[model samples]
Target: MCNSNSLSPVWRELKRLQSTDELFEILSPQSFKWNIGKGTQILFWYDIWVGVSKLRDQFPALFRLSGKKNEHIADMVIFSENGLMWWDIGILFPLNEYEDLQYQMLMSLLRNFKVDLYKEDEVQWTHSLEKVSSVAEGVRVMVKSHIDFEFDRVKVVWNKLVPSKISTFHWLAIQGGIPVKEVLSYRNCLNNSSDDKCAWCLDHIESIDHILLHYSWSHKVWTGLFKWWNIFWVVPSNVLEFSVDWSNGMGIKAEKVWKLIGSATFWAIWLARNEVIFNGSYTCWAVIVSRIKLKVFQWLVNAKVCESFQLYVWSDHPWLLLQSPSFDMF
Candidate 1:
């Protein structure tokens, strides 16, 4: 076991891998580098200390002739009596013309490089602003590299106005992974076809679209929101289409509030559905509309969108509240 007490924060994190029973896999080397300090802990040839690549890869022929192949960076430096630093890379054999040229190029590259003898070597994650290695940063780097397409729908799904749970629900809903009755039936969780009826209406199959959008109960919820915004909108076939169309129709001034309201509307309807199914609560669209308004008003106040926002004004005439001078900053 490595002594964690002696290691830097980054190395200490890396050391935890040794305790795992599974075969250790190396992460992408290009995403990491050593921030050379004293350089005592970093391998001169093998580690990415000097540049974007390791010295061994950059000068393979010179590395083959090096006597101290496994030497640390500290071992390659020689200090004169006056404290001038000089590189004394131990070359095992005489250099040909091409090898001598490589040697001169290597020396030139190291001429301006300075190492602090007092400071300890540190590992840096190239992708993060802090240059510190972390699981989250590593995952982000890896995911970003692999993703080739533009995922603009994620911007619509993950709204900063709502909690992560709400955003997560939206994400799942977009992917058709939400446990609506139809999905449950498909997964063999619901044995009876009768159990797949819409929880709100019980007239149509409880699909993601029906329960959340097209059904009379949920449709009224959307209609109430549109009436509040005073905009004519044709509800799309599905959640993703609805989000795209709604977003496209928003004006610059009302865009932020509109997005927040849209997210709140979906969440409110879902909550109402759960309550009706699980708690045997009342299935009134009017009550759910009131809840959506209250939810959005509270979110605006909590987010400090406007200090003087009145709920009564928002409930009666949300358009006027949005048009108020207080919201001009938005």
Candidate 2:
């Protein structure tokens, strides 16, 4: 059998295999590849022969409705007295609604690749990189696939120049994962009405955003820091938004310094917030601003972005220090 009708014999044998068959288990990994030179060995439906991915994974909807779900490419290709004839499985399967029309488009895509009839079809392992695959790199790619990590602000949080604890705190604050009063209330961690109010402002719910950016006390801290930098920009509404967009429209060196500034500001705000909440201490705006100044300088010096600025000078004229010709020693 060398035509479409020959698929019935092969389909019968595949159906007879038990559930624990090793052949089925061999395809368990999430990736595989096919070198479809002759297209004789690759299964058209069950194998990841086309689309650089498994047809089962890429087009699950079409695969479920397909009648010849286990047919090989050779079984569907007709080599008659007249030459080779390509037969799409649409004739054997009845697809309803949009799938009926979509099947033709899919078939056209399959027809585009030129099949070399001389070379034998070979199976290959598909990995993320074209280089030799290592278990460590493979695990890294696999772990990354499961995370919804699309945020650009992550660079600011995981900056190698900053302290690890400070970076972690900034990451948590940006993600709203910190156990602030508002979040605790939402999670039912707070039991009394007294725990619902902001520790610093005592006006509204103490959300992470509110405590970090919007509260009257914290507003002064952010604005004063911006004033110290001589940047006349409007403050962003949330920590994530601020971290991602705050350094835009600056040169490369300036942006690096600005990112350190943002990270340091977040760490300082969190430290001040915790002090007021847990220690019953009042951290004034000026003190917080000064902490930010010192923190930024410490991180920047360690970052090696700028080499020759004295601490007193950076504190007095922060933006001027960044603008000085000596700052070009990045």
Candidate 3:
């Protein structure tokens, strides 16, 4: 009855959209609920129609014993000659004492439920009185549920000295929205790649933290920067924590320039990663460190963060700009 080549354009687009994880995560129990009618369209066990959680999660023992794991709600209900509705759940084996107790609980939960066999099921938006879903509503729910970062990172990433693109990248990186190998794997987009290993190290999975913070190449770049500032440093677990740690450690006078340098360091390491992966050209960590220093110097001079200073002085004694009373303009 159906062929992929003969699918309507809208239907094809819908199919493509269904494969994305964003839709899957957004349509969770917190934001959306099913208004049961006939229940023919809803999965009986896997869907969150019966209660706050999925039936499989709520009745794990019963779910494990179920033979008809993929049965629909309508299929699990039997209609008697007297117009009585009864469960027809297909269990593979008899329940033990604990599972029998769970079964009793499940039956009690479903005792007062009624199903209308004639009407179709509908998805209702939990957040709205109208029961209609909108992208704005979905985004609001997602942000409220998911975001748990400190507000200080926002100010750090949006520094006047950093380029807008780099600032945006840092923001995305902090949110785990960057399309690194680990993220692409999570989105099921890394079909061609054998594994999500770091391009530079080829040892660990290439998460944002591994590539930008933990890997030897990126670690060396951070170490070089710390040595340049003559500060003892311990790397944090992830980008956001690193930003907060770095900010908290810096003095009031050094914070602005240090934030700029931090942003430049992340950008340079990312560029080096892309160079290896896309251009098939490899640059060492020492070169990446040099690039970060040069790029930060350029950003400072162009942004007029302070009076123009010689590149040699920046490369050799960069902390002088932060420590010197004459360069207090920063």
- All candidates: TM-score: 0.53, 0.51, 0.55
Of 2 and 3, the candidate ranking higher by TM-score: 3
Backbone clash pairs for candidate 1 read: none
lDDT of 2 by residue, 1-330 (tens): 111222245332322221112322222233445666777777675566666556656665676565555567766666668665565553445677788666777777777755667876654435446533344544465466553323355665676777888888888886668888856754457665246678876766688888888888878987897677666666677776666665553433477677677778877888888888889998778988888888778776775655545788888866667776656764
Model 1 per-residue lDDT at 261:
73
Rank by TM-score (best first): 3, 1, 2
Candidate 2 Cα outliers beyond 4 Å, as residue runs: 1-151, 249-253, 304-309, 323-329
Model 2 — which ten-residue stretch has the worst lDDT?
14-23
* Candidate maximizing TM-score: 3
Model 1 Cα displacement at 135 (Å)?
30
| Model 2 TM-score, 2 decimals | 0.51
Model 3, position 15, has a per-residue lDDT of 29
Q: How would you encode candidate 3's per-residue C-alpha lDDT over 250-324 as one tens digit per residue?
A: 654577777778888888888888998999898888888888888888877786654564778789887656565
